[model samples]
Target: MTMHLALSALLAIVLAWAGLLNLAAPAFVRAEFEKWGYPPALRVLVGLMELCAAVLLLWPNGQRLGALIGGLVLLGVVASLLRTREWLRLEYPLVLLAAVALVALV
Candidate 1:
C-alpha cells in the first residue's frame, strides 16, 4: 500500500479497535477519562459517539458523516483542553482535524 493508504489503514484500525474497546469496557476507559476531568456519563457518551463514528467511517457513503463527527469531536476536545489551560494538547485536535481533512480529501 502507498503511505497514505497505510496511514488510513492504521487510522481505521485504531478507530475500530477503540470503538470496540469503548463499547466493551466503558468503565475502564471512563476511569482514565475521569482523571482528565471528564465525568463517567461524558466518558460513556464519548465512547458511544466514537462507536457510531467508527461505524460511519467504515461505511463508504458515511465518510461525510464520520468526517463531520470527527471534526466535532476535535472541536469538543480542543474546547476542553483550552478550558483546562492546556494549550500544549492542541495538537490532539489539530491531528483530528487533519484526519478529517485527509479522509475528506481521499
Candidate 2:
C-alpha cells in the first residue's frame, strides 16, 4: 500500500482504540477526566466523535474529512495537555496531531 494509505490505516486504528477506551470509561479513563475537571459526560461525547472519525477514515472516499476531524480532536487533546501542564504526557497527542495534519494534507 502507498504511504498515505498506510498512515491512514494506522491513524484509524489508533483513533478507534482510543475511542473504545473513552467509551468504556474504565477506572483510569474516569479518573483522568475527573482530574482534568471536565464534565463526566464529555468523555462519552469525545469517544463518539473519535469513533465517527475512525469510521470516516476507513471509508474509501472519506479520508480527508476523517483526517480533518481527527486533527481537530488531537488539537483539543494537545490543548488540554498544555493547559493542564502535563508536559511529559503532551508529546503523544502532539505527534498524533502532526500525523493527522499530514494525513489531511496528503
TM-score of each: 0.69, 0.96
lDDT (tens digit, per residue) of candidate 2 on 1-106: 9898888899999999999999999999999889889887889988888998899888869998999888888888888888889999988988888888888888
TM-score, prediction 1: 0.69
Clashing pairs in 1: none
Worst 10 residues of 2 by lDDT: 72-81
lDDT of 2 at 18: 93
lDDT per prediction?
0.68, 0.88
